[model samples]
Target: MERKHKRLATRRAAGVAGVVFAVLTAAAITLVRTALPGGGDDVTLDAGQRGGLRTALELVPFAGIAFLWFMGALREQGGRAEDRFVATVFLGSGVVFVATLFGAAAAAGTVLGDGTQDSTFGSHFAYALLTTYAMRMAAVFIIATSTIGRRLGALPRPLVAIGYLAGLTLLVAGSGVPWSEMVFPAWALLLSLNILWGRPPAAAPRTAPA
Candidate 1:
């Protein structure tokens, strides 16, 4: 009973954290994309755009925090059945994604300061970190997570397929395509909803006495 209760608590935590992370991340990305589309060097921001950028930057840290909680809760759900190699990839990629995301936010923050040259450079740096590095890490995280879920029979085939598709999109087309980064948060939201509402895996059948 205690174990069952613990699992339920973890599931709830994962669902809540995942939803928060997805919403905050999507909002931040939208704000940033609107403020500095394509990360062009010559782009200029108006007062409203600047305010939006600031709001996006401010939301990033909290989003990162929620992501960490979401990741941790998912790992806990995997429990002892998890493969160490894939789990390592999952944890590493997630941590790196958050780090790169924070780095991008920091770079973007520099744009708010004086100097036109600094703003241009900051925007370029921010986009590079976000689209190139962070998204790639997110891709690996998604792929690894899907692999684990498949092995554990925790995720349906359709959901696993979607994870792979989204991960590949972020890996191959993220930097080349504008707004492709949204795929990561969208995948997270879907996976989180599954965890929240899907039926728990059934227990192994016990052998009858001989």
Candidate 2:
């Protein structure tokens, strides 16, 4: 009974962290996109736009921290029955996503510090890292997470399907499609809501190792 209660508490914490991460990330992305559309060096930011960008950059670190908590809690929920290979992928991708997110934010901060808008490389680099590399990592994380959830019977089929679709979209079109980066946070929000309010599924029996 104590064990079950502990698990429930962990689940609640994970759900809350996931929700916080999703909201903060989405808001940061929106603010950054609005202030520095297309990451073009030719674009000049007014005082208000710079303030918004600064606010967005400040939010990134907190979002990353929440994401780490969400990832750790989800892994704990998987327990000893999780496939080692898939779990490694899930963990690796999530860590890389957070690292890249921070790197991108740092680069954007450099761009913001340049009052003359001469840091074209910083602007482009940040944009590429965020939209291309970080998003691809996020895609991998989502795919691995969905696979684990499906194997463990924790996620519904429809939600798993949506995860796959969202993962593929991020993998293939993240850099090329404008505003496609929003998909990751949107999916996170949905997953968090499900974790918080949906009925928990029974765990599937673990398969014997080959």
Candidate 3:
């Protein structure tokens, strides 16, 4: 009984962490997009824009930290039913996604500090790191997570399908696709909500190793 309660408590914490990770990441991305011009045209950001960028930079580190905690919680929930190969892939991709995301944010911060509209390389490079590399890793991580959830009966079939679709969209969509990156956070939001809503019962059995 004590172990069961402990497990439930852990799941609740993880679920909340996942929601926080999604919201923080989404807000940071939105702030950056709103602050910087979307096109290739070089334009100087006004005071408001600079303020937005600064806020975004500040949010990113916290988002990354929350995501790591969310990952730990997710894996704990999965327990021994998780396949070694897929679990490894999921963990690796998640870590890489966070690293690339931070790198992109740092690059963007550098560009913001320089305030050089003519030097667009940093801006372009940061977007590439985010959309191309980070999101691709995110796609893989999502797919692996969905698979694990399905195997463990942790997620519903509909949610699993949505996960697959979201992953595919992230994998196929390029940087030019407007709001494409939003799918990741949206999926995370839904998943977190579901986890919170259908929390494990206090008497539920502890997960057993395969």
Candidate 4:
């Protein structure tokens, strides 16, 4: 009973954390996109846009923290059924993804702090870090998570298929693919909803002994 309660607690934590992480990351991406100059041809930032960029930067840390908690809870959800090799890849990729994301946010913050919107190199570098390295790592994380969940019978087939599709899109598109990054958050949101509301399959009843 105690073990059952613990598992339930972890599942709830994982679900909530995934939802929070997805929302925060999506919000940050939207704000950053809104604040970016048009067509890379201009480098001027209006006050509102500047404020949006700053807000996005501020939200990143909390998002990272929530993601870490989500990762922990997800691993806990796997319990004894987790494959060690896949788990290592999942954990490593997730950590790298967060680090790269933070690095990108920091890069963007530097450009904004210096009051120079015209730093083409700085902006491009930050964008590369985010859509390139960070998203690639995210793809790996998604693939590993989906594989483990499916193997453990924790995730539905539809959700697993979506994960594979999202991972492939991120891997192939990299950056500037028009709403590509949104896939990550969307996948996470769906997975979280499943964990939150969906139940495990019921076991068949055993026959009584004669």
lDDT by residue for model 3 (111-184), tens? 56555753477777778888889999999999999998887788889999999999999999957686788889
Which pairs clash (backbone N, Cα, C closer than 3 Å) in model 1? none
Q: Model 2, stretches more than 4 Å misplaced?
A: 115-118, 203-210
Model 2: ten consecutive residues of lowest lDDT: 110-119
lDDT: which is higher, 3 or 4?
4
Q: How close is each model in CA RMSD to the real structure? A: 3.1, 2.2, 2.5, 4.5
For model 1, give the 10-residue run with minimal summed lDDT.
200-209
TM-score of 3: 0.92
Order of candidate numbers by TM-score, starting with the best: 1, 2, 3, 4
Over 4 Å off, model 3: 39-43, 117-119, 199-210
Q: What's the true lDDT of residue 69 in model 4?
A: 97
Total clashes for model 4? 0
Q: Candidate 3 vs. truth: CA RMSD?
A: 2.5
| Clash count, predicted structure 2 | 0
Point out where model 4 deviates above 4 Å: 37-41, 114-118, 201-210
Tens digits of per-residue lDDT, candidate 4, 26-133, equal 999888777774422244677898899899999999999999999999997776567899999999999999999999898777556544654655667778888889
Give lDDT tens digits, candidate 1, residues 1-210. 998898889988998899999999999999999988756464577899889999999999999999999999999888877889999999999999999999999999988877488778888999999999999999999999999999989889999999999999999997899999899999999999998999876433445778
Candidate 4 TM-score versus the reference: 0.91
lDDT of each residue in 75-177, candidate 2, tens digit only: 9889878999999999999999999999999888866665554567777888999999999999999999999999988999999999999999999997789
